[model samples]
Target: MTLDLQQRANRRMRRAVITLGVLVLVLVAALVVIALRGGDAPPKGAPAPQPSTTAPKPTATLPPDDGGYVAPAETVKLPDGATKSGDLPVKFPRTPDGAAAMAVASARNAWSLDPQRIRAGILAYASAQYRDQMAASADAGAKGNREFAGIPATGPVPAGATLNAWPIGVKYAAVDSDTVDVLVLLRVTHAAKTGTQPTTTLIVSPGRAVWEGGDWKGTATDPNQPLPDPVDIGTVGFNEDRWQAIQEGDRL
Candidate 1:
């Protein structure tokens, strides 16, 4: 009957959302590995370096230890009458914090099940030089989304279902006055219906952004640049890694 069909549709939508979230997490993991490894394979005959017993020293760019986590000193500022591109915010200040904010927003949008938001996010957040590449990636993502949902890329979710991703914590390293590398801890969630328990996944994604055209814009991650270690919130490593919790007002 109609009620049975509705339940089946909701279940299908939930499965699609969960599958899409897993795909995003896998993609993020691959990107992080590439960044960490500098995306280079060793020369065919080059001998591998022997492992060192000494512990690796922390990178010099990290904030000075204050016997505890050092909160980011810079604050994000929005432009006058700033608006959003789809559900993603646009027009952040020309500062390090602004770059971090933009990177975080980009990650949230890129991981969402809504393909329209993914496209809009790339257009609004990526740097001019990277837009075409990001657009191609978005297209691929949209195609995958459509395949999983059995609907058009811009189609709405089944009634009573919810799928979304958001940043929960952030860490950043300043590459210079004009560029920054940001790490965002994301929470991806899906619910089949109101009052139902939601399925959640966590991801730590790395991103880079530059100050350009009077606002912060996302750029490809620097293969050679060292990034901070990712840490989950509410863990000891979180404090040791100096991850800062995203404030309520900062959520995109």
Candidate 2:
């Protein structure tokens, strides 16, 4: 009877050892799977990984770090032509394409803020027909301003201030073998001393030129309409001297 009881106890001990060994094998297999998957098994009640909620910031269009003193657009020029009025070309291109380039450049300059440059730019580049019309318009405008201000006809009268314009883009299309239609996008800035703030205006205006009598002469930029849509370039202070330099073709 004693031997039988001892044997029964030994059998029970063996059964318990086998159960523990099987449990340990199952735990080792689970750990191996987690290791192969490149991450530890998460604890119970732990939250799952979540997707990111961040977004990239917008790119800055204007410079000086904080949107002031923005860089101007690149200036386009004729390889064999004078950039400004009365600038003698050392060697002229004599090609129709070259003439078109010069015509476009001159037409854009006609929108200068300075009165003298504006007049000169128009006269130098415009066709005789448009030139006369512009002259008449200028006369009418000056006369109307004088009458409104009650200034004498012969006395000096100040005209309205012109906006500073920088040509940002130019698109040219050949209308004919001798004529080219040019469209210029200008960044026009108006500086206000007593107003809320200064602003930049983006204008895409029309220009047409014909290769006439060995040179290109500009026609009315807008033969069909008066003006194009003006886009606001946001509120910012403009450096006038820099714009003047660009107009003078010194720095673009």
Candidate 3:
């Protein structure tokens, strides 16, 4: 390839990667907003609840020797004939594993190349309490299937280019019988030209799933805390035990 052509390819690759990063940031911002604005404000003139004076019981903690890693204990079980709401999958089980599965699926669809698809995915997966808030912002400036979040949309893969993503790892915590928190790490690969090597980007996204109306639905993920930074797959700090490998059927 000519020098000019190579430079263009490099620019395209950079733009694609940046677009993915921006999409993640936008999603996070939306989640934070919903968390802050969700639920009813305290009734006018209502008294605040009193705090308990008794000391709380100690909860279990990971052993220091374990390097703060917690092995995945839940098993994902998808029901037969799992259905789809629009283009996004729906109807996961009610267990912690099911919540984790739904969370991963939500992240995958939220990053879709089509803005319409993204909007539909948000509507389908978001918890009822926050779904409208999330959907209203899903494609604020998107138009004509060419732009979303100010980046060029992935309409069709060119002859010499490719783009794909898959869930590689996950960490989950069951908050209660009706809620679960999940952190998912996705591996996104893109190439601007057939001969050029593909660039790999890692994205770690957190999601909360609430059991509502007999199924799991996505919600803001711990807005009081900051989101985790993305990390490379094989970095020294990466803990295999903490991030359980997502099975093929569960991946997107």
Best prediction by lDDT: 1
Q: Using TM-score as the measure, what is the rank order of every candidate, best first?
A: 1, 3, 2
**Tens digit of per-residue lDDT, candidate 1, span 37-117:** 232452111111110111111111222344654344323332331667655677777666777777666666665455456
Alpha-carbon deviation at 11 in model 2, angstroms: 99
Stretches off by above 4 angstroms in model 1 are 1-83, 143-161, 191-197, 224-230, 250-252
lDDT of each structure?
0.48, 0.36, 0.47
lDDT of 3 by residue, 67-120 (tens): 444334433343321778865668888888787777777655554434466567
Per-residue lDDT, model 1, residue 160, is 62
Each candidate's number of clashing pairs is: 0, 0, 0
Residue 86 in model 1: shift from native, Å?
A: 5.0
Pairs that collide in candidate 2 are: none
* Residue pairs that clash (backbone atoms under 3 angstroms), model 3: none
Worst 10 residues of 3 by lDDT: 46-55
What tens-digit string does per-residue lDDT give for candidate 2 at 129-243?
A: 5554444333332332222122332344334423344655454567677666554445544432334243443444444556655667654333233323222222222222122
